[model samples]
Target: MGLSAFQMVYWKACHLPVEMKHKALWALKFLNFDPHETQTKRRNQLLELEEMQLHAYDSSRSYKEKVKLYHDRKLVKIVFNLRQQVLLFNSRLKLFPRKLKSKWLGPFGIKRVFPNGAVELENPNDDGQQQSWVVNGERLKHYLGGEVERFSKVMMLVDP
Candidate 1:
């Protein structure tokens, strides 16, 4: 005579008397008991739960990767060549500044371009003053001036 799984669990939880524990084994003998089948069913259920958890984790990771790719695609690429004039975004400007003030501060000429995204800027008005700044390309944009259109010479006769 052997104890059924449920009786064994109850006996372990309550710490029943030795005589009471022995009586449950007599009841188990009256009913057919299969320990191998019960253990196999529990193992199968654990494997199923583990597989479901792994699938959920994979789906969550893939969704995050797709969202990141979408955001990356929407970003505009900014590149500055040598001698190109561009406006720099002034991030340090106060929240309540003058109404007439502009946040973008420079029409500075790009004196030199570095491979690692650093640019050397020179003010055309100042003869010898130049500043070297290591900044991301996102903080700059191309500057179009009316001086280029106004100063261009129109020649009627061409010498080929």
Candidate 2:
């Protein structure tokens, strides 16, 4: 038969009376403790810990929002249109690069512009590969110069 008590007690210490008596006698001393009071103290401590966790979470969320707002404010909004010429920034040059080497890759023509800041560029040199590739608008800058002939003109120095 199972026994129920108003307060929690270890079954080995209370249910088996013979063993408990033997242990108590061997110890030569017994101390009184209130189980209900111990449980209440633990419950109160748990409630306090939960409240502290909730407060920490709220503070962390507000801090993240503030950081995001600051970052958004600092970001520049880049705009591009179809058929516009632009230079692509080369970001993969990592080794001991030459100081005079140009970092910009292309004067590629814009084929299409997406609403989400992605721009499709047209390949001017027909390499028989993919005609277009999509790149982030932030990596492109406006090309201002006009088309110049690749052949160089030799001028004779004349003295009269």
Q: What is the TM-score of each candidate against the true structure?
A: 0.58, 0.64
Question: In candidate 1, which residue ranges exceed 4 Å CA deviation?
Answer: 1-35, 94-100, 124-127, 146-160
lDDT digits (tens) for residues 1-160 of candidate 2? 4655622454552447888777776665454545577689999999999999999999999999999999999998878878988877766543547677666665778999998888887764344553677778888889887652221111110111
| Tens-digit lDDT string for candidate 1 (1-160) | 3876766877654445886878777766667666688699999999999999999999999999999999999988678998898876665545457766666666767887778776666553344545454555666788875322111111111112
lDDT of every predicted structure (CA atoms): 0.66, 0.70
The true-versus-predicted C-alpha distance at residue 25 of model 2, in Å, is 13
lDDT for model 2: 0.70
The 10 consecutive residues of candidate 2 with the worst lDDT sum are: 151-160
The residue pairs that clash in candidate 1, if any, are none
Model 1's lDDT to the true fold?
0.66
* Poorly placed runs, candidate 2 (over 4 Å): 1-33, 126-130, 145-160
